[model samples]
Target: MSHILEWKTRLYLFEEDGTTKARATLDTGTTTLTGHGAAHRNPADTDVPEIGDELAAGRALRDLGSQLLDIAERDVESVGARSGERTDPVLGWSL
Candidate 1:
């Protein structure tokens, strides 16, 4: 059987206070992205901690997505070279 190992990512988001929030740990086995923030919302303020959490989480997930895409692209190129497959022009030949 051909053994294929895959990388996995995990993301977590939560509120820290009434107006503070965080997005913690975008992990891909060996790498992680973390973000924190203070929403600074008052009784009359339009902002909320949930907004902060969403913003932070979105940013973290975007970063993680980019990294994961890079890893996948590299792996695909590696496999294509090993198997003598014609890779897409955009991907090009790695070696």
Candidate 2:
């Protein structure tokens, strides 16, 4: 089965009031899913824009990944119910 498809995702980050915020959006043509995250700078800590950006972006992407997995799990259950929790055969771990 050749299912040649492409999904595009866009991530945006911004800093405001000593906080760095990030938004990750996945565009699948039919619908869009978004995840948000933020990192706050402590008043006593050193100000590092890069660190904040990295943290915020990583968190946003992590959130987005979780949402994507939930969608897949739901879709799988809709068409054909699973006897039990899904697991990766090779890894022998729960999915």
Candidate 3:
């Protein structure tokens, strides 16, 4: 069977008081998840806005990915299947 679904993600970045912060939201029709991250530049380091933005955004996305995985594990368990029992390398590695 072929399935088609659309999920949307939005990321926002801002800088305040030598710190750059990022917020990311993922909407999957039935559920929404959010993640946050921040980057701080040391006083002795050169100030680079772009670098800060990249660091903060990457961290936020990583956090969002972790949440997605957690949700998937819980969902699998809800369906009467053990979440971590798969032995296929591809499936095992994913969990």
Scored by TM-score, the top model is 3
In angstroms, how far off is 95's CA in candidate 1?
20
Q: Which 10-residue window of candidate 3 scores lowest in summed lDDT?
A: 85-94
lDDT tens string, model 1, 1-95? 89775555555665544544444455445765554333444567665566766766676666655665666667866766433333444346432
- Over 2-95, each residue of candidate 2 has an lDDT whose tens digit, in order, gives 8887899999999998899999999998889999989999989999899999999999999998998788777666766563455542233255
Clashing pairs in 1: none
For model 3, residues 1-95, the per-residue Cα lDDT tens digits are 99999999999999998899999999999899998889999989999999999999999999998899777777777867655643432334556
- Flag regions of model 1 displaced more than 4 Å: 1-45, 81-95
- TM-score, cand. 3 vs. native: 0.86
Give the lDDT of residue 60 in candidate 3.
94
Against the true structure, what is every candidate's RMSD? 6.9, 3.0, 2.7
What is the TM-score (0 to 1) of candidate 2? Answer: 0.85
Please, what is the TM-score per model? 0.46, 0.85, 0.86
Clashing pairs in 3: none
Better of 1 and 2 by TM-score: 2
